[model samples]
Target: MRLGSLIETKVGLNTRELKKMSNVTYYLKKFADNDLLLGYRPNSSKVSCNDEFVTAGDIVINSTTNEATIVSPLNEGKILTQSSIKIIIRDTQQLDLWYLCYLFNGSQFIKKQIYSLVEGTVLRRITQSNIQDLDIPVISLEEQKRIGESYRIFMVRKRLRIHREEEEQKAIFNFLEKKITYVKKGNKDEY
Candidate 1:
């Protein structure tokens, strides 16, 4: 989908009862380039520019709906606290911070929206305000915590599985090499 047309939902919770709380914050890429982020970490005070920094740790959001790794060093320490950052602080009690971080890092949900706003001549960047405007799924704080923990567990398991597979592959390669060497020596005896 084209980046502009992908954003069809609102930026916060859809509570039908009484009220839905929402918060917003801003971040900018200054010191880092574009390849150094895994995603935005709240309260991270690392910076590379000449300004008062508001580390990713301070910027809270429901989710990060942008292209690229949301937490790249390229973009890290670059986000400032000035007009360039545009911190959107929403008063959200339904959703907690961890859940919002998980949602923002999701791949399928953020692809088109991030692409639409990430525009620049040389850097291809998105403003902090634009990110706040991106739609996010809001839920109860308990649910948010559950989802966030699930995401963390899932990542840990995946890494462990990958490591095991790599070790198995290495063992297979070693066995094959030993067998090949033995066969070569046997054939040489006939000479």
Candidate 2:
């Protein structure tokens, strides 16, 4: 089945408009080296400038993540730039949202489908139309829900692992900083 039949897709905000916002918050992109971050300005008109605003349950995909993650309310109600694609499922009965996300992000078949449609000279870009036209395998809703649940669990574990590694690195850096300072001050009594 064509993905367009199952969901509504929209392009995000542009970089120029995002920069003008006062208190811009999280922004998703297709090719980001890091997670999207922006400042927000409550009083600024730029906040309401964009026609498309991402809401909770929207599946966002970018080049950096290379996968779709469902938006939590924490990241909700923010305007996205053109660098990412926002997808909203039309009917829960016909298609499972979680299943769609996992398939698009993890399935090699889906990746091939997307790559085949990608167009760019310097940076590869998959347009909204391209994504909408891609083929999606229709599966039983129960099976999709099960697969989606598994994918959600995997993501939780991945995040925990990354957090642990970051903490360990921070500890190592702190220890080295203290040790260097002690040596520089000639305060090492035992050594």
Candidate 3:
């Protein structure tokens, strides 16, 4: 079924919640690589994993509070979720969380609205009021399930490609190391 006719509400039961941080709940600004980031991966503690944020999964976007392009997931930030920065939407069983996430990523319908509502001199943002007014397209539970499954497949393919690239790089490095070793031995025959 079409979303406009499904139940009645902007957000379905599936909601977005920031995993870290406290305060500044409800509506928040999400940051990513100018794209939709999905999946749940642990942040790297070696350097700065918190700053490596994405606009995917259970996330609450907070455009206000602080203006930091890179927020540490391990530290306190405006976009981080705590007890206050959370919004719960009651879905009509016809919808699911994965579908909602995909819809959010689409951004075709809401991007313009968000840009129009966000107010700032240098940094643009979408306020909570904007989120409330936004409308989400609803579909049948089966459709939602299909969409969710497709998303999972896409993620797996992307990860596999990344892994392959890393392996190729490692092979190249190993080959170079062997060549260097051969050269040091004055074996000029090493190609």
- Please provide, for model 1 over 1-191, each residue's C-alpha lDDT reduced to its tens digit, 9 standing for 90 to 100: 12122221222222331133224222433222122222333343332223333334333222222322223333434323222332222433444444544555554466466667676766565555556556665456678768866654555566567679999999999998887897787754421
RMSD to truth, every model: 13.2, 6.6, 10.3
TM-score of each: 0.48, 0.76, 0.53
Q: Relative to the true structure, how large is the alpha-carbon lDDT of every model?
A: 0.43, 0.67, 0.44
Clashes of 2: 10
Candidate 2: residue 54 lDDT (0-100)? 64
For residues 36-78, write the lDDT of model 2, one tens digit per residue.
2111112211112234666655667774334676655566667
Best by TM-score: 2
Error of 3 at 60 (Å): 4.5
Q: By lDDT, is 1 or 3 better?
A: 3
Would you list the rank order by lDDT, best first?
Answer: 2, 3, 1
